[model samples]
Target: MKKTFEVSDRLFELYHRVHRLVNESMTEEGVSLARSKFLFFLSKLGPCRSTDIACALNFAPRTVTEAIDGLERDRLVMRKPDPEDRRAKIVSITETGRVVLEAAEHPRKQLLEEIFSALDDEELDALFDIVGKLVDRTDEIRKRKDEAEEAAQIAIAR
Candidate 1:
């Protein structure tokens, strides 16, 4: 008998393939996924601190520092002392960064549009609905996993 979970397996495969495509496309432009994400975030959110960026990106402070260092070195971003907080610095994208981001936006959107162009409107809607459901389910799973780990630690300590 054939396995029943083939659809799920195929979904996972598609997910990985899409991720690889994005990485490959971005890599050709000489940027990693994390760097691209940080640049995009900075473009959207204006100046933000390293700590806020780390939390928003779900990265460690050290990792954020490394990315920021590279971006600053590349002249894509600048770190200025936060006027409100003397101890902390905020990162701001440079004019060059804005130009790069604007240039990247069209190609990225075009690529994704082409990828999804095969689907009809109804299919596209259904795909989005399914993705939303999956996101909710994943969030619940993460919460449960965290709670389970906490419970296990408590049990071991008692």
Candidate 2:
């Protein structure tokens, strides 16, 4: 008898494959995924502190610093003292960075379009709905985990 597949298993496989493809494709485009994501985030958020970027990306502070250092050396980003927080520095993407980001994103966008082009409008809508539910479920799980941890800590204090 043939084995039935689970949705979670399928989702994990798809996620892994897509992630690997993205990494490989980005490398061929002469940019690391981390750098591309950083540039994209900076573009969206404007100048932000290195710590903020680290928090948003769930990366270590040192790792974020190193990435910013490399971008700074490439002249793709500038580090300036934060106006509101003198001790912290904000990293801002340069015009050159914007150009590079746009170039890198064009191919990625095209690849996504090509991949999804086969799906009819209904299928696309269904996929979106399913993905949204998955996102919500993930968030719920995370919140429950957080609450459990908090409860455990409170019990330990008593």
lDDT for each residue of candidate 2 in 27-61, tens digit (9 for 90 to 100): 67766667999999999999999999999999999
lDDT of 2 at 72: 91
Model 1 TM-score (2 dp):
0.83
What is the C-alpha lDDT profile of model 1 across 1-158, one tens digit per residue?
24537878888898788777766766566665567888899999999999999999899999999989999998989999999999999998988877766666666666688889999999999999999998999999999999999999999999
What is the lDDT for 119 in model 1?
Answer: 100
Query: What range of 10 consecutive residues in model 1 has the weakest lDDT sum?
Result: 25-34
- Candidate 1 positional error at 1, Å: 12
Candidate 2 residue 88 Cα shift, in angstroms, is 1.7
Model 1: lDDT to the true structure? 0.85
Error of 1 at 96 (Å): 0.9
Count steric clashes of candidate 1: 0
- Given candidate 1, what's the lDDT at residue 121? 100
